[model samples]
Target: MTTTPALETVGITKSYGSHSVLRGVDLAVPAGSVVALLGSNGAGKTTLVRILSTLLRADGGTASVNGHDVATQPGAVRESISLTGQFAAVDEVLTGRENLVLVAQLRHLEDPGGTADGLLARFGLSDAGSRRVATYSGGMRRRLDIAMSLIGDPPVLFLDEPTTGLDPQSRIEVWRTVRELAGRGTTVLLTTQYLDEAEQLADRIAILHEGRILTDGTLAELKQLLPPSRVEYVEKQPTLEDVFLALVGHDTTAT
Candidate 1:
């Protein structure tokens, strides 16, 4: 039998008093696919995530996680999905292993300790398993936080700016992990401000601006929305950076 979409939002709208945050936003994420929500700040990315995860209610329309409605069936939706926000939520007082164990226990796993240890190893935190989260580096804590999110092995994962504060190496590491998760059939809805990140990881992309989706399509399709890729010949070898600067007419290094 065919499975339902891992996530779906139809005509979702949200507002803050007189200020509208989302206006009839619609989205659908197929099972085992990675969908990147691309937007600048105040574009309603976080608000969308919150509503989908059942933390906030939409003013209109509806959303579902694995066929469970976010409004009337929030508990079922919560059981089928996991969310990791921009900031790591690991407890400073708990050890890396302890945090994972806590999550497993909350999920009512039969063997929380074993599951936690396995996750610690998977995220390369085996050596730091016993170390207090307070002493772990930013990357390590973020890894642990993500590990905790996977304790239940939920089918749908929502990652919102997960690499925001990480160093380059750590960001790459997280990217690899995300790719691996999607490869293993986890439906991922990722929100990121980094255009390059979306280009690299998204199977499909949706651009959000001013609380509405400006466009949604594959990377190649989105590229087609812009001008055609131009070819410039030069005697010297021009780097991708140079090409980007020539095409976009802005110094990428300055940002």
Candidate 2:
């Protein structure tokens, strides 16, 4: 039996005047799995995400989330999904716990305080729950933003360049959170420009280029597209990211 996709788009098109952002893009993401929409800047990844999130209308074609048509049933589509954008959306004036409480209350969940506390613990922000968000590190702020988005427990999640501008350790923190979310059966549609990020997180990867999907497949499948390679011995070196992570250590307590 085939499982229905949690998110899908077919012949999806978007344009601004003479400039086209998405040109007949087609893609599908399986339920409870992460699918990375990898692309360079201006590759229409954010446009597709906005359309699916009901934040923007598509010029043509169709898209859906959790089986609800994005065009015809936008309310239902929004109800089933959560969107986290490039920057953290937390209120700097509010404490971490207060931010979570605000979202829970906005979502009209019962026991909003309890919900906030639970989310704080889940996101490993419990120790800093009373601290103002202004004092939090980039990683902490991003984690709090994500925790707020989870208040409604939306089945589908759209993370649009979630780690953009974050430090290496912070990026890794967000990555760990994404992995945990996927483990709990959340369907994630992650848009990213980072090849390593996609390779690390996505169960399947789709490369969007020139407003179209250039390729969509597992990492190994994508590698097979290149010509057969001859073996060559190469010296191993720690990458900048590796050096940074090692020097900074993995402790979040300093934040």
Candidate 3:
């Protein structure tokens, strides 16, 4: 039996006046799987994400999350998903625990304090819970950010460049958390410039370029589409953008 996608889009289109940001994009993300969306700086990845998350409306075409139409049933879509953007949305003045509490209150979860404490411990921030977010390290703040997102236990999650500026170790921590989330059946749609992050965490990957998907498949399948690397090294090295160029071509790689 085929499962209905946790997230989906068809002929999705968007534009800013004369500039078209999206053009007839089609996508389907399976339930309980992690899918990574790869793209360059202005490839409209965020635009597509925002549309699915209800932060932005598509100019045309249809999109849905958890089977609810993004345009017409936006409230139902929002109720089933959570978004974690490039920057942490936490407040610096609030303690780590307080930050989670704020989100819990906003979400109307019962026992906001207890929910905060549970999330703190789950994210390994239990000891730092009382410390002001102003003093937390970047990784700590990110962990808290994700933990706060999880308080609602929404079935679908959108992580937009979540590891962008994190140190290597912290990036790994976030990657691990993402894996755990998927393992527990959360459907994750992650967009990132870090190719390795996608390779490491995503069960499938889609390349978004020129306002469209050039090709999408498992890592091994995508590699097969590209010609064998002519330049070999003592240590195999394929930069994320190298993979990007190989699969999607150079049209979208403009600096």
| lDDT values for all models | 0.87, 0.92, 0.89
| lDDT by residue (tens digit), candidate 1, 1-255 | 124678888999999999999999988888899999999999999999999999999999988889899999999999898999999999999998889888888888999999998998787788889988999877777778888999888998999999998865567668878888888898999999999899889999999999888898889998898888789986998877567556755421111
C-alpha TM-scores of all predictions: 0.89, 0.97, 0.89
What is the lDDT for 239 in model 2?
92
lDDT of 3 by residue, 128-161 (tens): 9999999887778888899988988999999999
> What C-alpha lDDT, on a 0 to 100 scale, does residue 172 get in candidate 3?
66
Pairs with backbone N, CA or C atoms under 3 Å apart (clashes), candidate 1 = none
Candidate 2 local lDDT, 1-255, one digit each (tens):
125799889999999999999999999999999999999899999999999999999999989899999999999998999999999999999999999898888888889999999998899999999999999999999999999988889999999999999988889889999998999999999999999999999999999998999999889999999998899999999998778878879775457
Weakest 10 consecutive residues, lDDT, candidate 3?
A: 246-255
- At residue 16, what lDDT does model 1 achieve? 98
Clashes of each: 0, 0, 0
Ranking by lDDT: 2, 3, 1
Off by over 4 Å in 1: 1-4, 234-255
Give the clash count for model 2.
0
Model 2, residue 93: C-alpha shift (Å):
0.6
Q: Write down the RMSD of all candidates, one decimal each.
A: 5.9, 1.4, 7.7
Error of 2 at 149 (Å): 0.6
Candidate 3, residue 68: lDDT: 97
